[model samples]
Target chain A: MSHVQGDAKKLLARVRRIGGQLGSVERAIAEGAECGAVLQQLAAVRGAVNGLIFQMMEGHLTAHVGGQDSGMPEEELAPVLAVLRSYMK
Target chain B: MSHVQGDAKKLLARVRRIGGQLGSVERAIAEGAECGAVLQQLAAVRGAVNGLIFQMMEGHLTAHVGGQDSGMPEEELAPVLAVLRSYMK
Candidate 1:
């Protein structure tokens, strides 16, 4: 967590929001919300989680893997970024 | 919840797994795991959530707008499925 940089406050807020979203999702399902509504809520959560990943990636890239400053080669970064992209989609 | 079909057992299991994954992410972050590892965990969680969405979509589709047998026109089902597909990615 300490290693992660760039707007820690925003990241913390996003994490809290995700927790709350997950809670709502559980409640919606438990209380028997319609299938459509449940799916919508789940999708929203998915989007939120995806946003968080993007933020983390941005922060990491700026701090450690900035293209100009990083000693690591493009080939090395490519596979890592690809893995991140795969999770994102 | 009742409207969703095609495996209540599996859906419940997926939900529980997601909850557990979230807990692990939180724990890992708190324990000061490396940035790459945290991202890995978060990505894994994201995939888990996406998998849950797909399962939910399948279950809902089977019960409701199932092609041919659903009594729903293609035009009507198309947009609904499109929305689901957008979230899935």
Candidate 2:
């Protein structure tokens, strides 16, 4: 069975952090915060989110496609590849 | 040794596609492509890359942190978490 997975506590914490960042962005806009400051925070949030994305991507590669010992066959690897290819398009 | 990982052929194909898209972007800019068209392509590229990132992230979680059978302990999973946390910063 493909079990439910992931570091739940950690993921939750990440969501919280991102949420706070977004909140700050909203507040900045609501309170007439400097454009530079607002943009800087937004960029930070984007970068942070991207960083998380990379980690998850790396983890996925290690688990499914690369496999622990038995490598995923070409046929099985196709969907995984298709997923990646779609993003590049 | 963390053996060389990822689907080389597939990854190569992805890079090629992304490269082509980027080239198109460059050409569009050079040829004074319409702002709307340029923005649309840029957005498409961003979305595509994000999709790839999600796949990788999902794979990593499945392989390492989730584990096929033996669940990774909290101690062992810390580094993985740290990586994730950094991204969400």
Candidate 3:
């Protein structure tokens, strides 16, 4: 299996948390929490989803595209890593 | 501005890479690369998107939900962190 598939359990766990955060957002809205409070929860959910995307991207690049095993030089990988690191910022 | 917004440049860079990866997949298909090859590219794109999602989630949790400045106790944060760490694994 590819590295991402091998790590499916962990990835799924993260997705589950994202799901939970979404549910929290819903509950917050339903309960008529302050607008600011509900927005905070929503923002949190968005962030979580973004985080998941970042992790998947990094794994794909390292394991599938370039890695120590892939014999790709650091010089070749540097720009990609820079982009990724910036993206995670 | 929120931390995520403050880091928008980096995040956008990551998103751009994801866009580039997606385009590569399209090009691979157009060139009629072998099924396995195309599949590999597609998988990489998927992983990249997932990586982005993962990073967003972690940032939200730390910067928005709980953090050193948030004054939330580590005891309270532990379960959430555990969930996130497991998700990232």
Candidate with top lDDT is 1
Candidate 2, residue B16: the lDDT equals 77
Residue-by-residue lDDT tens digits, candidate 2, B1-89: 11115655665676678778888999999999899999999987876665555545555444544544533433544555454344322
State how far residue B44 of model 1 sits from its true place (Å).
1.0
Each prediction's TM-score against the native? 0.70, 0.41, 0.47
* Deviation from native of the Cα of residue A84 in model 1, angstroms: 8.5
Q: Which ten residues in a row have the lowest lDDT in candidate 3 chain A?
A: A26-35
lDDT, candidates in the order shown: 0.73, 0.60, 0.59
Candidate 2 stretches with Cα past 4 Å from truth are A1-4, A72-89, B1-89
Name the DockQ score for candidate 3. 0.04
Per-candidate iRMSD: 2.3, 6.4, 10.4
Model 1: per-residue lDDT, tens digit, B1-89? 36553354566677777877777766666556677887898888788888778778766775667657678866776688777767655
lDDT over C-alpha atoms for residue B15 of model 3: 55
Per-residue lDDT value at A35 in model 1: 76
Highest TM-score against the true fold, candidate: 1
The worst-scoring run of ten residues by lDDT in candidate 3 chain B lies at: B26-35
The 10-residue segment of model 1 chain A with minimum total lDDT is A1-10
lDDT of 3 by residue, B13-74 (tens): 66566556555644544454444564565556556545555565666666755766676765
Between candidates 2 and 3, name the one with more favorable DockQ: 2
